[model samples]
Target: MRVPVELDPDVDDEAPTGDTITVYDKRHYVTYLRLLDAKAEGADWKEVAQTVLHRDPVADEFRTRRCWQSHLQRAQWLSREGYRKILEQAVANKL
Candidate 1:
């Protein structure tokens, strides 16, 4: 079953991938931060899926779960690898 997700108008809801980097990661910086905060607080994937990803968990449990997990993992990576570069680039652009 394909999960029907209603992406938040303010968020950049690109498909999560196994690739080490993605353009959406840079675009959705604040979304990644929110995901990181949720993970830090030990939030459940179901909650994150519905709230953050706008996924209907009950409609397609597997896809919803996978979506939340993959995006959350990508969010972790964004915090470690990508975010610093974004900050540096922002500072550089200012100079």
Candidate 2:
């Protein structure tokens, strides 16, 4: 059960179509985070919402410099059920 984290709208929903895989907000970010959490690594959570992932030149730049790190810090809260909790919520939400 993957928790469905809301993806940012400015992040674009066009789903990339190329060899270069650029993940937006909740797309692979959530899955990848779950993978890492399972292995005791890390993942970011805050920027999952579409609003946060905005691609607006100014907004993106601001998020890149300001929100990125803080969002990733959620990974530190990992625990036995932390990943499970996230997944459950994510799956329920669906990207």
Candidate 3:
């Protein structure tokens, strides 16, 4: 299930899981979680995280809040653009 990703410098994406998406950043952890809602469900958290985030180091601030786990509990709170970025990233990783 390993895949490769070629980052585009022009794209604003760069945040790791659990980190806050800056106004400038096109994607973030929350975005990915939202996309997973329709793409997968129940017990798919780990897979979605691994695939979208690739286990990138999450920020300490976000980690303290356990935001990723917390989001898993709620399960649906991302915006449309956020969701699109998640699917885009997932597709990018496949290339």
| TM-scores, each model vs. reference | 0.69, 0.27, 0.30
lDDT of each residue in 1-95, candidate 1, tens digit only: 12223234243234455544445555555666677888899998788778877787899898778777777777887667766766766687789
**Each candidate: what lDDT?**
0.67, 0.40, 0.42
Residue 82 in model 2: shift from native, Å? Answer: 4.3
Q: Could you give candidate 2's per-residue lDDT for residues 1-95 as a string of tens digits?
A: 33345432333333333223233333545533543443353323333322343433354555553443333343333333345654666577775
Candidate 2 achieves a global lDDT of: 0.40
**Candidate that scores best on lDDT:** 1
lDDT (Cα) of model 3: 0.42
Model 1: what TM-score?
0.69
